[model samples]
Target: MSDERDPSPYDALLLLSFGGPEGPDDVVPFLANVTRGRGIPEERLKEVGQHYFLFGGVSPINEQNRALLAALRADFAEHGLDLPVFWGNRNWAPYLTDTLRDMTLAGHRRIAVLTTSAYASYSGCRQYRENLADALAALAAEGLEPPRVDKLRHYFNDPGFVGPMADGVLTALEELDPRVRDGAHLAFTTHSIPTAAADTSGPVAGHGDGGAYVRQHLDVARLIVDAVREETGIEHPWRLVYQSRSGAPHIPWLEPDICDHLEELHDQGAPAAVMVPIGFVSDHMEVLYDLDTEATAKAAELGLPVRRSATVGADPRFATAVRELLLERAATERGSAVERCALGALGASYDLCPVGCCPARTPRPAAAGADTPL
Candidate 1:
């Protein structure tokens, strides 16, 4: 092991996320930031963003991240990790560039970033790295020295993550009418990307077929299903499904969306189903509008009872998992062999993203990887 133990090379942890508007007025601008290069017109964007108004034009992600920040700070202090944690978003208030400037001004030279996203894809991984690089470039233009930044690896298969989700499945099953509980199917849901993006996610074509994105989700779904069987003595039938697809319908994204799958289950005489969002870290807009609002509405229409399982949002065990990841990465950075904690078939992901790990359609400077332009 290294001569040092905790928080040695790292001076701070940055909780980076995709931000959402806090109110009606912020919605259009937030969407504009998200679709910056698409050249979408304001009126057209407003028409597309009409669904956000249904929830008072607010998103729960910013608030959820606030709670998670508190949990991380509390956990780190309790464990005596002594690492200062900061929060920032890519598209809204507390923006990434501003946060990095603040950190550098505060004399923090080294920072480790953790994102709300837990998987590998262009949008999930490489895009965030590109955002980091852009923010650092902005800081440099502002005459501030850029802090060295590294992003944490994918944690989809971490026990702390999968365990809570497994419990969520069990709890949702218990909430069902008990008559339908035993027969209820488990549908693991994740965000749908274009087929090309899925094919290129993670390392080395992510090992064929649906690539690392689908492969990783499958591994997690199987692990959760196995855990449920071990506890309840019933092997719940399950399948990995996709959700929250955007972009042109002609592009062909991941199929059998959660709503459509619900319809299929109903027609097939399936008693009930649980929507497990293993793809997301928190119950963000996608979980709320897509699953809770839209999919639930679809299920109600089909008379099929369904409950959405919980995301890992602000779970204490998840906070502990973040702590463990920090220590593990710290040791690895020190050239010390450390036990990397993960569950299921994929094992641990790389600490630093490899070259061409998850390439964006149009190339851009992305920090925190072998091919980082930083």
Candidate 2:
């Protein structure tokens, strides 16, 4: 599968991600693109945009994506995968449509997309597919041959994903003062989606409503904790907490915000803590502001020493994982017997996102589901 002469079934790989502002001027407009139909006021957006403004009005996500792109290209070249990697974002420049146009112009047809989000939720999974659908539709309208896009499966449980996070957690644990390192608690954090969205995360077949999202996170957190325990011989106390909640207060989201969790750990007399941002693939705005800035401040207020581990942005293992996933999918498309790569108890995620998986609140055009591809 790694041989360039063998020819991959897919001609191109698309690195799909959630985009962020590149400059002070791009902050509000980027936020607007993210919250397009939500009716969030400009004033409120400015208030929320303070996170980026604090950092020169730029989001770290774009740079991180660029790094990942470079890493993927390098890995592909080194491994002789012979696939060109293209990048696109959902909410900002180098948009999906533009990238798709470039791919088509280059005469590439079959495409594989690797989204940054590793989970299975409406915003994480379905919304990205919806974006792909929109891009394909636009290309079709322009009389271009819309490519067939196969979204790689959710990789929350893959060793390529978990191994890096485990290493990160270990590094964060080591970063704590030696006196408090043994007593440090692990707070694994992820974006807080609405409870309603949580209720419908995976396929309706085997997994009950919303079970896939929480289950995958729990599995990954357990895997990381176990990996850390095996290496350091410390069974650190840990809990999965949510962050970056954006819905109206009245509407319920995931409970035990990272800040509140820190308070609880402090109350429990935990000497220090390590934040494992297992939910994200990179240190984007949510991670920078929510965890590094806001959560760190709260931990300080509580006198709880804390360290945030690095995200798997452009980690060689992660880039290699992308290549492996692509080949795995290509092998499946070719009807070849290939070992399904995964770690943890739940096993490898389904290659084809099943029918009724990650159902959206409203009907929208989505690609690469059980029946649709675009």
Task: Using TM-score, give the best candidate's number.
Answer: 1
Which numbered prediction scores highest in lDDT against the true structure? 1
- In model 2, the Cα lDDT at residue 41 comes to 99
lDDT value, residue 18 of candidate 2: 90
Off by over 4 Å in 1: 1-5, 205-208
TM-score of each: 0.98, 0.97
Give the per-residue lDDT of model 1 (tens digit) for 1-374.
23333876899999999999999999999999999989899998899678788888899999999999999999998877888999999999999999999999999998999998999888999999999999999998988889999899899999989999999999999999988999999999999999888888888745457788888899999999999999999999998899988879789788888888998999999999999999999999999989999999999999999999999999999999998888888778878888788898889999889887877878888989988655
Name the weakest run of 10 consecutive residues (lDDT summed) in model 1. Answer: 1-10
Taking all chains together, the TM-score of candidate 2 against the true structure is 0.97
Clashing pairs in 2: 199-210
